[model samples]
Target: MARNTERRSALADAGIRVLAEQGARGLTHRAVDVAAGTPRGTASNYFPSRDDLISALVGRIGERLTPDPTRLSSHAARTPDRDLFADYLRDVVRRLSTDPHVPLALFELRLEAARRPAVAKALGAWRQRAFEDDVAFNDESDLPGGRTEIALFHYAIDGLMLDNLTAPIDSGLSVDAAIDELVDRILR
Candidate 1:
């Protein structure tokens, strides 16, 4: 069991390193094994299937990169400060933008999953779970086309993150302005 854990950890680290250098499309079990200083056969011993390896790599990447929504929820509950929620989201976006490797890998996985129903299902579940609690606070209860408004809100925030990734130095685009516009238009 200890050996299995060690190998898994090593493989994950190797995966991250290779992903950093070569991006997700370049990821291969043999490449990870070499980066991990393990025998060529070791990766297959640990991950007999491509899906298993990709799943593990994806999980590891999420562990290292994504913000924990539970933490955000707990913090917001404890503080009762709306600004804190905004700050939390801002920090999460900043991390996503500045961390080029993880964001790029996640983008790659998302694109790959587009044609794979199972992968898309898993990714969708992850996204829903991550954002559902915060999204509940969005107050789209009575507006006309509320569902479409909610979807557009999500789309705008995602677009902001993409913009941030490209222009990491200047995100003067006010999140406050975006949120206010959303509230005025969608929540009225």
Candidate 2:
């Protein structure tokens, strides 16, 4: 069972790399096998279809991107709410800027999900889980406005991420400044 789990994880990681580098068209079972350094037919054994593979990839990407609670708590211990929020946003943008492949692969998955119902269903579930996690995090932090604030925060961050990922231009505002502005608006 452990070996199976490991192999699935490896394949999912490989799929992320492939999706990032080659787009959705290049995400084939055989391609994942090659990227994973596994023998032929390995990816197929785990994910029987393209939808299955994509579903797994979405879950894997979410796992990789979710912030670690211990790290968050440590940072939160010393900072106030607004500063903590800004710092969290800064950290997310920094990660996206540094390792663009994760977000790039996510964009690909999102686009592919549009034309594929199975992928769309999977993505919807993933999104719901993400939303629940965000709500829980905000509640734990004792942030005001509950789910509405969390949703707005997500929208603001999503816009920032989309702009940075798609049309990366010098907006004349530093990332930290933009995050501070956003934090002020949301927390006000």
Candidate No. with top lDDT: 2
Q: Estimate, for each residue in 77-162, the C-alpha lDDT of model 2 and write its tens digit.
A: 86446777677777767666666778888888889889888888898889888899878877887654478877887787777888
lDDT of 1 by residue, 155-183 (tens): 76676665655565454547666555544
Candidate 2 pairs with clashing backbones: none
Positional deviation of residue 40's Cα in model 1 after best superposition, in angstroms = 1.8
Question: Which structure among the candidates has the greatest TM-score?
Answer: 2
The segments of candidate 1 whose C-alpha lies over 4 angstroms from its true place after superposition are: 1-3, 20-24, 66-79, 133-154, 166-188
- lDDT of residue 63 for candidate 2: 74
What value of lDDT does candidate 1 attain over all alpha carbons?
0.63
**What TM-scores do the predictions have?**
0.65, 0.89
